[model samples]
Target: MTITPLHFVGVSALLFGIGLLVVLTRRNAIGVLMGIELMLNAVNVQLVTFDRVYGPERLDGQLFSLFVITVAAAEAVVGLALILAVYRSRGTVAVDDLHELRG
Candidate 1:
């Protein structure tokens, strides 16, 4: 049988769930950022799939996905910079070790 929208949606859901799990379980800042990126990619997949199925005449979905990618890139850059600064200052990137930010 040919591929379907349902399949794409299921894959997206699975990806999002995996990303969520990663974010919740990781103790490292870089791992959390990777999870966030995965979640963003899942969203982009869903957007493009739906757009392909329902609005093939327009590029709204693709455009939105591109925007999400751009945002994700910016987030990665900023996140990595922050992580680097934090590591330099605290000598670690573990989330649990960042107790200074809780105050």
Candidate 2:
């Protein structure tokens, strides 16, 4: 069978679902970051897929995806820095361990 927009959407949904699951269940900071990244990628895929189906000439979807990628990069850097700081202080990267940061 030939690949279609529906297929892309399906895969995107699956990836998003898996990412959400990871975010909900994982206790590690790094794992949760990875899940967020996965969810972003799924959104990128859907954006491109819909753009392709609508009209590839405009390339609006590609541009939006690029913007998202830039944001994701910034998020990763900031997130990793915070995670590292937490790990340095607590000696653990678990999300639950971060409660100590509260006043």
Candidate 3:
């Protein structure tokens, strides 16, 4: 069994495009957060693909990907917390509607 770098790049590109579309089109804070996550996952896929293709010589990419995943998880927690706080304070999760900073 073999996987080509082109395939990984194509998948990563697709995921990145989808994430970009989501970020551009969504108004909800949670939806925007999900877009950011998708973008991060796309980058992770590229990192893992490069690591696998380059063997031991490219271990740093995989290690960085692991760190990225960890950071992404922490970001999700913190981002959700902020979103909740914003919702409580603003009474809405729409990014445009949160301008007043008041509920």
Top TM-score prediction, candidate number: 1
The model with the greater TM-score, 1 or 3, is 1
Query: Superposing every Cα of model 3 onto the true structure, what RMSD results?
Result: 3.1
State candidate 1's TM-score: 0.94
**What is the lDDT for 19 in model 1?**
99
Candidate 3 lDDT, tens digit per residue, 29-103?
A: 999999999999999999989888888865978998999999999999999999999889778899888665567
The top-ranked prediction according to lDDT is: 1
lDDT of 2 by residue, 1-103 (tens): 9999999999999999999999999999999999999999999999999888889578988889999999999999999999998788779998887675466
Tens-digit lDDT string for candidate 1 (1-103): 9999999999999999999999999999999999999999999999999889876689889999999999999999999999999999989999999886554
- Would you list the rank order by lDDT, best first? 1, 2, 3
Model 2: lowest-lDDT 10 consecutive positions: 94-103
For model 3 the local lDDT of residue 7 reads 93
Each model's lDDT comes to 0.96, 0.93, 0.91
Local error of candidate 2 at residue 8 (angstroms): 0.8
Runs with alpha carbons beyond 4 Å of true place in candidate 2:
101-103
**What are the TM-scores, per candidate, against the unseen true structure?**
0.94, 0.92, 0.88
